[model samples]
Target: EVMKQPGTNVIEVADAVLAVLPDLQAQLPPSVHLVIKDDNSVNIRKAFGDIRVTMLVTLVLVVGVIYLFLHNASATLIPALALPFSILGAFTVMRVMHYSLNNLSMMALILSVGFVVDDAIVMLENTVRHMEAGESPLEATLNGSREIAFTIVTMTVSLAAVFIPILFMGGILGRLFREFAVTIVSTVLISGVVSITLTPMLCSRFLRVVHAKKGLAGFMDRSFDRLRSGYGRSLRLVLRHRLAMLAVFVGVLYATVKMFGIVPKGFIPNSDNDSLRVQLRAAQGTSYYEMVGYTQRIADLIKQNPDVDSQMANTGGGSGNQNTGRFAIQLTPRATRALTAQQIAQQLRGPLGRFPGFRAFVNVPAALQIGGFRGNSSFNLTVQSLNYDELYAWAPRLEQAIAELPEVEDVSNDMELKSPRVNLIVDRDGGRTWPPQKCQALEGRALRVA
Candidate 1:
């Protein structure tokens, strides 16, 4: 069984295993056949593709929003150009830092889209305002950039500073989000530079003053004028009632604190990846064939579910004993299925309960599968003690208590305290006095008993 080291990359480990397969196969006896029943790299690749597509969609949507507000192709294009430049600079930083384009980094990239465009948008709007006041594009670019340069620098530094705490966070969260923090910070810094440099240059070259708007542009301008005036009136009224606004702000702050305490906390949120992990366990000391029978029975029931696309069941592999089996169940695409993997697993609990002396655990595979984690479910708890008797005695009570909680389900432990055991003791003096043949005979019997 191959197990990954904690903090190591899953894809890199899988690739290393695959790279040696051909040589390993050649060394094996002709009678032995090698088969790969599961490969996580395939799913990782699929997720990467999906995330890339989502990032592209986010870019397009961000650009569309910019165009809708700006109403001029040249004005919109300046920020659009800045976005890619900022991203490229961020990629360079990622390469330098030896960071992989994993989920967290990709998420940072998606979030950075808005931050990257903001700098350029600010520069473009201010420059266009100068152009509307009858200054030439070159003169407008020079004066507008000079005015906004300090603000851009301050905004960039403040935004990056917000993530500084995340960069220094301790434990697994710190390791995971360090990349996220760095990516956004680098992107923001790059966008700031681009805004102060390339943005003004582009505006000077591409921007043209338009004194009048027509059609959709004219309607949008009129609507924005009304909105700005209404907003001004509301702002003035709120400023006049300073005490009321301060009370409202304090109320919001208190509510935010309360909400933070009330919300459930987790390192990573669950995702529906259209797959489920079904773990089958029989009572300890159960034979491998008996476990196989239980596995097949569960597999048959799982096959009856229309949502299940395919499933593979196996017994006695990896760290599992003869009494344990597992099923890697693939579900149909999310769009075609009415029930999510978690919901289907919950529903299956009823039918799975019909089997006596067997426990079937169903769970969706975590979107972020941390290396070195060996748990049937997303949450794992370990109880450690030097005293075996005390540890075993306490485990069941803890498990039962946890199972009773409304938030927990399918609570189980690996302790096999019910397994039959035999204790053997021998008297040294008695064994020394025994004849050789008799001692040999006793040893043979002990082996048979074992």
Candidate 2:
């Protein structure tokens, strides 16, 4: 029955609720029981925990790859140092922007791992190359930095520019990715600064004078030389057959465009949160007691499945419709349940369909709620008109048409007009002559109706 406000942490709110639960229970009557039928914070914590592990693994792999290529602990350490500085700078910028360590930002940081290291690698490689040519450590560091400083700046600016369009994007996607773009841009800028300022100093202090290669370093150098020679030959062959290469490029472009059209399109990818939502509506004017009975029957039906952990249902309120009932159903954890939430929802459709005068919709909550599009369904279509009669007539027809489409399912509409009612028409002018005593009984009934 509780919903968190937008832009607030679900975990923090859930924690606060847990902290006060004992007192709340003490204040409540013994007949009432409190339960957490659904907790989205569980999903949030698991998702972010995985992301944190990914970030750590990415950092280690990036550093490990640097060590493999450079073959020197000192050489590897310089660029490795850039990672934390750039990441810390990103964190500082995120704090300033009032951003949390949410999914989008974490994903951006993961991608920034590669970008931040690129600048440092470039500076370190150039400096190492100068040292291999017999320059002193200080001289190599200074000359190498001076030579590629402009290139580094240009590369950083160009990389940052790639995400500039995302900042100005509009709507839900824009809002979600704006933080992503800013994080990447800020991380890259900070990395470039670290490469220019910190990387060279570290190289000068840590890098020893070049000596003859003997072991793993020698083997890697030989392997790289062969790769470079092969690449050079391939490049020359492509340049010699420029027309053929152009044709290949055109073919690739055509295939890419074709595949783009063939692929299914969606604004957000589906995710499993180990929960489902059930919304049921009885015929309009159905009494609250009838709805409660229907809700209990449905709940009992769902609970018969061992996978269902708990459900919370309410009738006649919270949904803005007197005839509607809502159930926030929580399933057992994914590891414990044999079937996914979606699959269970599908299985229940047949049994739930047998209920007459009731429409039941089983849906998984959206992975991400954007703007006002937070319904259990994936898409929302709104129809507007100046005439209520026209709207009421067309809405159900449209719903039926959409439901018949092969690509669509679970289509529903909220146009209610069939509620039982009594219509009374009176002749106002003639009523002036009616005797007050004669109308007294009717007036009492009319008051009750009103």
lDDT of all predictions, in order shown? Answer: 0.87, 0.88
Return the TM-score for each candidate structure: 0.84, 0.91
What local lDDT score does residue 207 receive in model 2, on the 0 to 100 scale? 85
Candidate 1 per-residue lDDT, tens place, 157-263, comes to 99989988898898877877899999988998999999999999999999875679898888989999999999999999999999999999999999999999999
Instruction: Please list all clashing residue pairs in model 1, or write none if there are none.
Output: none
RMSD in Å for all candidates: 4.2, 2.8
Return the lDDT, model 2, position 312.
80
Task: Using TM-score, give the best candidate's number.
Answer: 2
Superposed model 1: Cα runs more than 4 Å off: 1-37, 316-318, 371-373, 420-450
